[model samples]
Target: MSDPFIPFESISYTKRFLADCYERQSFANAKTVSYHTSYSFIYHLQQGRLYLQQAAQAPIEIKPMLLFYGIVQMLKACVLTVDPFYPENSTVLAHGVTARKRKKQGYRFLDDEIKVQKNGLFLHFLDKMFHVKQMPDEKYKMNFLLKQVADMHPLYSTMHNQDISIAVTQKSQSYMISDTILDDLHMTANRFSLFLEQSPNSKSWFHRQKGITALKQQITVPLHAAPTRYQSAPWLSTCDGDIYMLRKREDYCSLPELSIHYLLLYNLSMICRYEAEWWGELHHTFEGNDLPFIKQFLTSTTKKLPLLFEHYLFSINER
Candidate 1:
């Protein structure tokens, strides 16, 4: 099952929270810009919410376009929290990623790819949120993005007979990762332990639970410190009463899950807006695996993206 939608409180009441965020982050001239920044924040957030709400009533043909705008607005709001004066210039306003539309035979959305642009919301978002510098000029495939989500765990398992995750169970202060993950990641316990240590947001180095075999033959290891037990790479999600550490394609390990969501919505929105005939045919024919993957991805996005950003927005309030 996918993550349940747990969007943050309504946008109407978040101006104060946002202003405070500006001040808390100690952005230059926080006092001078917080008012205007908070206003923009509310506008972006409201627009995001409105678009997603509209997408809920939209048909499949139009859903991606609406959802992409919604997702972009949400991201803009998040960026404002950090940048204070976002869009410092017009160049940052572009989609930041471009999709290639080839008329070659057997064109499938699953095999479709999007290339990351050097500057734009995608790059700025990555820099501000994750502090990633110098991404390669590489095209990321849709299938690669799909495999990163926990929601797709069941879908891929059922359809292709391929498992994408290692079951993770959390008990109080620690998470037990399925040792079966060893074969999936092709790493020994020590190597895997080292891998997790190098992940983003590594506050404390985690180690294996000593001298005991966890139930169901899992390896018990605590991922973070108390009260804010965040997951690192090979993501650990506390949602839905279990943790799913998804094993994704190469170069995906370091990316934030939200980035993948953004890329998916970006490409789909491009298809919906620019590739009319192809999109129309796909919707009418219900052909192949693309439809189901896109269907499930949208379902997962509308429900989870806002919640993920909500968690992010509020979490930084502590800083």
Candidate 2:
């Protein structure tokens, strides 16, 4: 059987287009990164235009206009450009990454609005995506990273909110969220992917290869394979910013670690709602008095994830 996921024609067309584009424009005409690899460079409107030129040459029906060579190969390496009128960084562009599925058909709906950017749009796009470094352990200390994560844990919410429901999908049939959510999810997943790809000299989770592998696998499953805990509590969807944090505490919560780490980071205590076995939220507070406990909490939570998947996988096989 053929590989269900790879788009063969699209890959061939992109390779050929890259060669022809470099030939016509000259090497200097394209952007350069610190590395010599062709895919390593930061893509701009010029590169986007080159892709457009290639699309014109081959015109594959499935290809998207804006594609990134991911440091790690996963479901999110390719992204489509949309709403060219909006600045590339506009949060709306992130919304373009969503894969739509109808419950009856069980297939992803493709987007139609993808197009190449002219070089003029590159700088503006870069401006929108600012780098946020891991807070120095000291900064996390200030923010009560330990307490923050504990509070954000999804298990707490699941246990507390009777209105919320938990359902697990099999690995092969996971349902995906909307593009806006997918865009954010992809960006977050890519960050972890690259983190794992790098050979880090400093202290980091990158050293944990198994954890990284499991985390990476978690993001791309079919909805039926992925367990989802959603809240039906009123006023929950309307909340934004810190208010969302507040309302989340009041309504429903979840860890959703299988989805992305940040989701767990944002709603730590919420995971308690998903699995009653979780006890961290009830025991810990962001009191600024304890750091080791918080650090231990982070370590334990991250470690617990693999077991969660093991249980999920075992349950699926049993079914």
lDDT by residue (tens digit), candidate 2, 1-319: 2322222225443344344434443445222211222232224323433433343343221111211211111111111111112333454333221111211222111111122132322222222211112111111121222223322334335434531212212233332222232243234544534532342211221233333222333433222122211111111121111111222222222212222222222223222333223223324543332224323434443333323333322232122
RMSD of each: 3.9, 22.5
- For 81-189, candidate 1 gives per-residue lDDT tens digits of 7888789999899878888865467888888888988878998988887676637476888998787777777888887887767677667667767787766777777
Strongest candidate by lDDT: 1
Against the hidden true structure, what lDDT does model 2 obtain? 0.26
| Candidate 1 collision pairs | none
Candidate 2 structure, TM-score to reference: 0.20
TM-scores for every candidate against the unseen true structure: 0.87, 0.20
Task: Note the clash tally of each candidate.
Answer: 0, 41
- Which residue runs does candidate 2 get wrong by more than 4 Å? 1-28, 31-130, 138-155, 161-319
